[model samples]
Target: MLDISKLERRWLKYKIKKILPYTLLITTVTILGFTIPFVLSNRHSSKAMIPLKKDAIKVKAPNTENDEGAMVLEPSMHFIESMDTPSTPITNTPTSSTKPAPTPKHSIAPIASLPTPTPAIAQTQATKAPQPIVKGKLTSIKRDDTAFDIHEIEDRFKDTSNPNLGVYIAKYHYDHGNYSEAYNYALKTNSINNSIDDSWLIFAKALVKLGKEEQAKKTLQLYISNSNSQAAKNYLDTLDKGGSK
Candidate 1:
């Protein structure tokens, strides 16, 4: 027995020192392994690894674009952003995104025989055309002395078998600019009707117009729970902006 505890302490220290260098080396190797692949993938792509044949990867001459997929449509980010905003114009002049001049336009000229646009006289037809009608039906409820009593309207709507009578009345009230009454009716009707989102929205619109901003916000949040229309989104954004001057 050559002082066993001393030997054990020395052995542990030696093992720890040896293990620390290898552990650091392993960690460095793993970090490099992940980072190298991530950086390469981001900065440059490996086109050679792509399975497209040479024929499929055809390139057009300089100034010409490959138009095989020219008809394919892409959604624009600018269009999406503009949907919710009044667009301030981008002032930067764009680089020419066009390819080489189209061959049909390049060779064609006023000297060559060409078809003329139809004259206005030729385009006009001598027939009466029907006017466009919007989808909503106008309720006879008037803004004059003959408007429906709010209580009677609410009571009648409470019991009416017709599902849309309440909505029709809400729209009628909204059209008349009776915002407080409209909000009241919509709020009560929505509570009675069990999550009718449209009613809640009419309430929200009225609240916004009436300058009850917090209530309008809550109403919109409730409505947005059930709808994704751009109209709803715009209304909610209007509420967020504290309404227009």
Candidate 2:
């Protein structure tokens, strides 16, 4: 009976050992199945709670030039400060070039503006007659007479080569403020006889009156060098001092 009991115990021990291994394996499988699902769910919940990193906020730089889609930027503090500051006022000083040019003391009058020589003077000089060699003073017009016939003198000048007539005409024209005619007549007289003091005087004076002072001075200088006239010297001195006559 003791041997039968021992054999029964051994059989029981073997069965327990085999059943214990299967029981531990089933318990491990069941625990792993439940824990795996729980861990997966917890991981998903933690990921959702962590707030997935959102796309970074993006901003483009502003463009100053013409761009309808571009945002307008406000002026900076420095620009605003510059606009508020007062600038220095510009002062224009009159330079030498800005000043009005000085008017010449002896300005030549335009031909149109020049005084009429005489009523018949223009008509008589219009058709120049042939000049002939003749002598003697022009007794037709007196030196003291203010209402002298200029036409007659012009006619006489055209008809004769008398230098005295030229002198008379030049002197008459000068006295009447007809400097152009005076210059012409004086030039003609000088051409005939340069030694005539009255002709030289009239020519020089006419030159100055007609705004030819330099030419007048040169002419006088030449005459003085040749003739050594005291009167011509005086006239040159007067011209240097800006005296017309």
The 0-to-1 C-alpha lDDT of every candidate, in the order given, reads 0.47, 0.58
Off by over 4 Å in 2: 1-148
Error of 1 at 229 (Å): 5.0
> In model 1, which residue pairs have backbone atoms overlapping below 3 Å?
none
lDDT of 1 by residue, 162-183 (tens): 2244543564465456777767
For 1-245, candidate 2 gives per-residue lDDT tens digits of 47998899999999999899899999999999999999999999888765543211112122323323332333222212221222200001011222422322122222222233432333234322333323453212112222334556566676664666676677667756789998999899789778766678778888888888889899999999998876677777767886544
- Candidate 2 accuracy as TM-score: 0.40
lDDT score for residue 111 of model 1:
12
- The prediction achieving the highest TM-score against the true structure is 2
Looking at model 2, report the run of 10 residues with the lowest lDDT sum: 88-97
lDDT of 2 at 190: 89
